[model samples]
Target: MPGLSPRPEAAAFLRRWREALIGACVAVLGLYWVIFSFGLMIWIGWAVAAAGVVLGVAGIQRARFRAGSDGPGVVRVLEGRIAYMGPLDGGTADLETLRALRLDPTGLPAHWILDRPDQPPLAIPVTAQGADALFDAFASLPGMRTEHMLRSLNAPGGASVIVWRAADPAQKRLH
Candidate 1:
């Protein structure tokens, strides 16, 4: 034991490529099954391969999200409700009651503006403590794309973005 020093090379390697490793493993397993098996096995392989590709793409997005900076407030989500408490402003929005979701980064601070019927809009900074969770919350909306939201979130400031909009025409659109 005195002459041996523990090596973390394997751990380091995995830490860097964990998602890609999983994706490759899934893809290889799927290909192996499809090539070596038949009938139902091939269908199963296709499922695995599809999942592998989806996971690989998600991994890349996740990496980009991890690079996002922590913004200027605390964001809390509960039972389809969201609340933002910041130094300059704070408000709450119910996901169930949400009529529209817009992003305005052109301002001094980027904001996720939630619009609800008969209620004032609520704006939460993009860098809020729990903003990352909004990625999933926003996705729950009909036809919301997590990847698109993430991309818009990381885009350079200057223009606003519409992350989600209800089918109801009453929903507001911020130009």
Candidate 2:
């Protein structure tokens, strides 16, 4: 007898969609409660189902944001700052001070150009270790469209695209 195992593609799909799968399960459970229960439980079930849908959508976005960790760097996001440690170069950028975000797909692995006023742009490879953290960081930017960012990320193009920009480029102060 031989042990059963998932194929490579199936395993990868599972790994990428693990959070979404959990969210779907939660939604199913909530729907079940909504169908079988009554009174306050039904309202609670509706809330639960809504929350699960939100989670599932976010999980899908996150899964799409993740490329791989085979690039030549490591990314770290802490306290509203993004730091990249690459083999040849590295830099840190404060999220609050960023002026614009661009995706340069001309490169082999592609690089995210984090631009700040009066400073050298920090370029982090999309496939760098922990690069997925950029999803949350970029999401925090006011007026950023997650769908646009995701589309630009996976789009086949040779030119760089601006994903986000500060409403008032001169206004660097948070307050």
Candidate 3:
């Protein structure tokens, strides 16, 4: 079972979930203070509290989205032989191996695109640091095909992607 076991990326998703939860809590606290400091009516406080709760829930949902497969860190191997442990509902392309990965920093939530021929691309939203880690890992793999680090887009925290290709240079494309 060489690739049967889940990859380290699975663990990364969980770690991100925890971090998001903590960040959400801090945000909620800040919202509470902002609302209370304004000294609005009791109803306003309740409204603000409700809003915080909604935001917290949204953050949790986002974490779950990322933790699931719908957000980021989702890896699709190939057709009929997909390996997705995240929350996305559909199956993925059956790739023989990872061919090329393109990082798109233009998106509000930066995206990672894995390119494989004859199959729809696999897209995942990733943090700037996560993208860097992915690039490093892919680069270290034996027989990696990627070559250039094309134009640097304005990624959060100045993160850039490492481009890889199987037969030719992967074109810098945004999804």
Candidate whose lDDT is highest: 2
Poorest lDDT segment (10 consecutive residues) of candidate 3:
146-155
Measured by TM-score, the strongest candidate is 2
Per-residue lDDT tens digits of candidate 3, residues 33-128? 666665555456566556656666545544432313334444533333444333553234333455766676666466656666776776656542
lDDT of 2 by residue, 106-126 (tens): 987999999988988999999
How does candidate 3 fare on TM-score? 0.34
lDDT values, one for every candidate: 0.77, 0.90, 0.51
User: lDDT tens string, model 1, 61-146?
Assistant: 65555423356888888878888898887888888878788989876567888998787889887767877667657778877877
Candidate 2 has what TM-score? 0.88
Please identify which of the two predictions, 1 or 3, would achieve the higher TM-score against the true structure.
Answer: 1
Pairs of residues at least 3 apart in sequence or in different chains that clash in candidate 2: none
Q: Cα RMSD to native, each candidate?
A: 6.1, 2.7, 16.5
